[model samples]
Target: MDVVIKDRGNIKWTAIMLPEHVAAVKQEIINLEKVNQPLLDEDRLSEIEMLIYEAMEYNLQLEFKLFKKGYIESIIGSTHFIDYIKKEFRIKDKNELTHKIPFQKIVDVQKV
Candidate 1:
């Protein structure tokens, strides 16, 4: 006589998870998807700075890609305030909500 056995991995364990444990597992999955920040060359950094300067001087709308906490975030807005000493700038979005970002966090810049 022979017996057959089957293996159920993580799915079988999920049945015993409480609601809070399930939520925590979902959040862990999301955190696992986060990516490392991209490195920018000097030429690329110069280009981004030039674009930002033009946007601020000409009152043009610009889109900025930022690296924050291992995630890439996009912001569309016009440059509102720049603090040179602090090396950070503020942008006002379409909804007039201002967001302050640091120079080192900038990944890319484009005209809108």
Candidate 2:
């Protein structure tokens, strides 16, 4: 005759953890999943700026890749507002929702 054992994984430890401890462990896992923002070279930045200007001048829809809170996000829209003083620009998406994005957060831009 032989005996077998089973692994319960997180289910077993969760029962012994307090609510706060469980929450902290969950938060730590989320933090670990996050990534660092990428750095763009000057040439790439200039290209993105050019694309933004071309899209705005020709009234074309464009897609932008942005870095936010250690995550990469993609947005498709047309230029809405450009604030030179604040160094941030706004875009109006298909739903007519406007989003303000900073230049530093910009990763890549493309005409769509």
**TM-scores of the models, in the given order?**
0.77, 0.83
lDDT of 1 by residue, 37-110 (tens): 89999999889888888899999999999998989999999999999999998999999999999988988889
Q: Which candidate leads the pack in lDDT?
A: 1
Which residue pairs of candidate 2 clash? Answer: none
Off-target runs (Cα >4 Å) in candidate 2 are 1-6
Candidate 1, position 4, lDDT: 81
Q: Against the true structure, what is every candidate's RMSD? A: 4.8, 2.3
Q: Which residue pairs in candidate 1 have backbone atoms (N, alpha carbon, C) closer than 3 angstroms, thus clashing?
A: none
- Decoy 1 TM-score against native: 0.77
User: Looking at model 2, how many pairs of residues clash?
Assistant: 0
The 10-residue segment with the lowest total lDDT in model 1: 4-13
Candidate 2: give its CA RMSD in angstroms: 2.3
